[model samples]
Target: MAANKAKRPLPSAQPMRHNPNPQQILRPQYGLRISPAGSQPQRSRLHARETAQLMPVKAHVYRTIAELNGGFEKVIQDLQTLRQISFFRNDRVTAMHDLICRVRAQANRDFTMTLHGRELANAGHFDGLCIEWEKQIEDRSDT
Candidate 1:
């Protein structure tokens, strides 16, 4: 009876699991290449093609931001001029209020555009524009 119960072979040991390296997916021509040493995260990893692609984007973003900021400045100056005019005359309150409303609307639009620009690549330097706009409107009671 003992001999009939035949010995069973032991199970083989499990194999070790393999760890796979992360796969790098490159864009058609706009992705940055990783540096071998990885010393600087921002300055070192930029590829030549990606840098060229970013130049035009950076220029356009800066130009747009500058123009919008200039427009805001002009509108604020105009409002200031209007305030000075109203100081000498009480009859222009209604007109001044209407002009203020218009200027406020334009400023709102500029703020929205600045936010949209932030979504674009390399256009994150919009804080200056936002701060300038806010500073101009800070003293005004109409805003």
Candidate 2:
């Protein structure tokens, strides 16, 4: 005999709960391959030396240039602040102070790089010409 206890209902299993894989919502080309999506991706097993060899040194130089540019901005900020509360003995001294401040303030640019950046600037123009020529010949049959 039960001692005034209310019995809890057992959860009913749905048909879908037993199915191992869910349905693919998208078509083949638009979505991931089934096995790969369900499994862990293959990882590179490179050592530290190998990884460094594979890394782009140019990209690191670019990043360092960016960091240096940021540091230049902080220095410029300090120089500007110093100018606002500067003391000078003579007109020449004050003029020197102003010149120093101006140079420091001018140093804050978006980036500094080993590259002149001229080739990079012309790169887009070259790409555009290439694309235009390709389009012109894209529809033509080979001779």
Clash number by candidate, in order: 0, 0
Q: Give the alpha-carbon lDDT of every model.
A: 0.52, 0.48
Best by lDDT: 1
Task: Name model 2 segments beyond 4 Å from true.
Answer: 1-57, 84-143
Report the lDDT tens digits of candidate 2 across residue range 11-109: 332223453333433323322344556674332443333333332234455555555556555555555555566473455555665775566455533
* Candidate 2 accuracy as lDDT: 0.48
Cα-based lDDT at residue 48, candidate 2: 31
Give candidate 1's root-mean-square deviation (CA, Å).
30.9
lDDT of 1 by residue, 17-129 (tens): 67644453322333444555755323334455345333223344445555655665555656556666745554465476567668767876885576555445344334444
Worst 10 residues of 2 by lDDT: 6-15
Colliding pairs, model 1: none
